[model samples]
Target: MPTPDLMTAELTLTGRITTASNATFLGSIGEVEVVYKPIAGESPLWDFPHGTLARREVAAYMVSQVCGWDIVPRTWLRDGPFGEGMVQLWQEQDPVQTAVNLIATNQVPEKGWKQVLEGQDEDGQMVALVHEDSPALRRMAVFDMVVNNADRKGNHILAMTDGHRHGVDHGLTFHSDHKLRTVLWGWLGDPLTAEERDGIDRVTEGLNGGLGRNLADLLSVEEIESIATRCARLRLEGRFPAPSGEMPAVPWPLF
Candidate 1:
């Protein structure tokens, strides 16, 4: 049998995800489940222009594809029950697996994980911020840097049953300024692997081709140029960078 056209299929709203700051829905396109965030429901942000978050979400997916990282899930813009929105294929994450976590400072694992920072929790107990030391997460960090991802919370990193990691909620991306705030800072100042370097090279090459043309529709010329510049800088540095800016390097309520 032929596959159904998800973009044009009738979308049925099964439920709403009330926990989201923006309006988000759990819906189905034919038999396929998806998470829908309509542009019309996007709240106004002081830093980002209105009615553009959905486009940014799609743009992040495009860059992920260009980099061959598969970090973001399959996402596209389409009309939904509310209005035009960003619809992404829902991924079933492994219930017992998480890419990052908060653990007591003394309980931090000595290997296979990277400690990002140490701080006190609500009860004033010492806690540590850490993430899995894996290539999948490193790729996500690289992707975030290129996109200027402003809010990469710990929970945004989904660990799938297949062991692949996926990053989601990319509405706060592509700002021309250096607004990268994320939880995956474990690789700070570490050298990039050859595969990671190659991925960056692929993104840079794509910018001069179809990827650049596609992004032109979703991002400003300055934003696109900034992405190219970031790739170049990362390549030249050949290492994961330490966060540097007036803003906090990590997002609040990290999870």
Candidate 2:
């Protein structure tokens, strides 16, 4: 059988993902399986506008592509069983590999990992948040900053079997305000590498052209401007930024 054109093929809902906060579904289009989050099913949020989450997801994908990082999977907005929504190619993450981990404070590794923070676990035992130190995750961290990702939960980072890292669930991104909540604070205060700076430059340049035009349809002018400003700021600072603002630095439940 021929492969389906994901962009235009009819999407059939196979099952509902009950664990999701919003109405999410497992869908198939020809030979491909996808995760679909319909706009009509989005739970209203005080900070974000109603029904715009799907667009934000797609916009994040576009920014990821422009940066040439491929951090976000193939995502787009299309009509589904409920209505127009965000659809993304499903990735099978390596079940055994977790990019971020919570280890006992005394058991934290001495190498190849960055300790993000230390806290007490539910049992009041000392624990530390640590993540692998690698270029893939660094690129993802930069992507999150550029998008102003407000919810970068640990589970959102998909560790692929082939060693690639993919970031998903980007609906809470591109807010005009500074809302950079995430569990990937391992690189906080570190200097940006040359490659990372180049990626930021690429995004900064693209925003004035095709990227800017495309985002205008999905985000308000202020939000688009904010993204460009973030790129510029990151490039100038050349370092990972520490968390600010009254909001928590990490997403609740972390995972």
Minimum summed lDDT over a 10-residue window in model 1 is located at 1-10
lDDT of candidate 1 vs native? 0.93
TM-score of each: 0.98, 0.97
lDDT of 1 by residue, 73-176 (tens): 99999998999999999999999998999999999999999999999999999999999998889999999988999999998999998889999999999998
The TM-score measured for candidate 1 stands at 0.98
Model 1 per-residue lDDT at 241? 92
Clashes of each: 0, 0
lDDT of 2 by residue, 29-54 (tens): 99799999999999999999999999
Clashing pairs in 2: none
Q: What clash pairs does model 1 have?
A: none
